[model samples]
Target: MTIHSRAKVHRMFELVEPIATVTFSDVPNEAFLAIGMRNYWDGYFAGRAAPLGMVPAEVVHAVFYNFADGEVARHIPWVWGKTTPAEAIAVRERGSALALRQLIGELADSAELAQVADLATRAGLSAPTEGRVLYAGLQALDVPEEPVAKLWHAATPLREHRGDGHNAALVANGIGGTEAHVLMALAAGMPAEKFGRIHHLPKAQLDGVVDGLRRRGLVDAAGGFTDTGRATKSRIESLTDELAAPPYDVLTPDELDQLIAGLEPIAAAVEAADH
Candidate 1:
């Protein structure tokens, strides 16, 4: 239904209340005011029987309605529009599906940090309420061991990784030491492109990697890679043999663990700071 501004606050009240689930003890004098947009997410969860949403209306407004972030003191209309529970449900379902598909699919395919980020944006558009969750969740996904997985897991740009392959090829063809540079770039968390440019490599050859993986059914390219792609990532990580003796110069296991822990917050900060 086309919600009216006059009724919007009331509609929000209805959605936020049931999900708040405050008991007598939990209720505070301040609870009466609509849960400040800041607290909505912390006090909430996703899927069913949770807060009206995984995120606050402000976040939804920002994502869907193109509402720029406001300073804390900025005044907002009492109600933007009346969004019913039914509307929230429809919005959530569509958003979640879009998030899961785009974010995961892109991560599986590119294996590069930038591509993963781009997918996060694409998926974010699917469901603003849950887009952050989806975007953050995809990082935790295990990349496969195929070409696609390598592209993603190398955490470098696709072109750079390909250049590493080319460097390797040159070394393999008796020109220079390819494998060490490949490992070094991967270890340093630099994009494959950086290495390629630094080493004066031509464009990395992804066609063969992509095609070979496709022919072997190691990747579900149609869906942006697959379980097979995830497997390929694992294998490549193993082959890099860094897991056993990972380049401490880049990241140690403990350091990697710390990075993973802060991954979501860091990504959010990066996005927030961009504007």
Candidate 2:
């Protein structure tokens, strides 16, 4: 199937997010408690154009303030004050190489995923454009300079940039975070109860968001989006694509197509892994 640049980018995210975020699920509790904090912090803090020294509270204010007021309490479950920001940075700086190295080994061992990587290599995406975009985001990071992850590093940075750009689109369109999440849930055909967990809103707060959406004619009483809501979500996605298009400008249409083709099987493989 033919895919647009935006769709290709979204597929790339499907391939990468699982890899980048598996630290939360795959690593042992002790290992995660020990080193995962750095991974989480760097992944979020990096590629942001905002100023440095943004504590978790400040991060909530800047990015998620549009959601419920007490979201920070519900959202961030990690122990605060357990690790200093400096120490977390230090850990990410020192440990990223090892973590990335191990991840590379893991990917290498997977013949299924290896085929995907090989396809990406054959698609003229092996080095320059992907690396360039990856490093561009790394340059924006508040962390001290360090060597790039060197393999599949592009995925994390690109995902981060996409997330930032998506947020910008939502803000520009006057969509609150809760409403945005609800819109997406409707698009995905998710049930209502899942909204509370997925969007970090209380059930009552989520109902409030739904009620507001209903009043706006975006959602019906049953929680599905109306036609206008679907159109609005499409526009939001289009705007996000426009904002995210800059880093990908260097890539030709053919290359983006190749990327989409190359990543589809890998994304499918990832999804089927637990089945």
Candidate 3:
């Protein structure tokens, strides 16, 4: 069995997802809260924009077309106008750290998170520091947030950074946006036709992507990944892990071990709260 077995990849994803989710998906009750939602979004965009050198809003607008459609991206000022990139970045570094600290504090005071503090500390140390460019960038802007939130916040940038890297890798390797979408669909086991429909991409274009992938021996006529395709996916995942590992350099081995041991219960508690 390969080390980056599907299960291993999924488990790793599960461990890191909670922290990332609360920062975005777990918005306040209203869709648009004056303070909480905007601040959270500001931090989110800030973290996202860091690698791009705080380019102007128009640059973000131009590039985001690859990720989101015009109507959707155009609706918000963060994506287009009202807030300047500099301000967004500042808010991201300051507000997110503060928010993370407050969230961790709330959880620690009301829940059993204190029991896992040492473990969380250890776990942070355990994360490897090499090849994690995105993680390292976020770490350079490190704040005094509480341990768990700090870890959580730390995890988000690495994840997003890897995603950014993945997009670059795809383009560099001659895969266009449409083809990249198809490859991801194959990796995730979604039907190509359905994926095309859901994403509002044309069937002909998607079929073209699949055909190109087949010619390259990356997929089969049935649109499933060939052995070569699986290998490629694994390589991409490995590359992503390498890119995400740099921030954990600050943690010592013992701290990493304790964090590994401690995170499960805390994660479970977070899940329980969500339900």
Two-way TM-score contest, 1 vs 2, winner: 2
> What is the alpha-carbon lDDT of model 3 when measured against the actual structure?
0.52
> TM-scores of all models?
0.19, 0.66, 0.63
Candidate 1, residues 206-257: lDDT per residue as tens digits?
A: 3333345456554455424456545544445433222112112233334433
Tens-place lDDT digits, model 2, residues 1-275: 22345666566656656544433333322343474444443333321212233346545445533455654443243433344444543444434434443444445445544444443323322222332333343444443222223223344455555566777788777788767877878887896558544555567867888899889888987888889888888998988766555544445677666656655554454445534
Model 3 lDDT tens row, 225-253: 99988887777666655444433444455
Model 1 Cα shift for residue 141 (angstroms):
35
Candidate 1 vs candidate 2, lDDT winner:
2
lDDT, candidate 1, at 235: 49
In model 2, the worst 10-residue window by lDDT is 45-54
> Which regions of candidate 2 deviate over 4 angstroms?
1-7, 28-30, 35-56, 64-67, 73-80, 86-138, 141-149, 196-200, 252-269
Which sections of candidate 3 miss by over 4 Å? Answer: 1-13, 26-47, 50-80, 85-107, 110-137, 142-149, 164-178, 193-198, 271-275
lDDT of 3 at 29: 15
Pick by TM-score: which candidate is best? 2
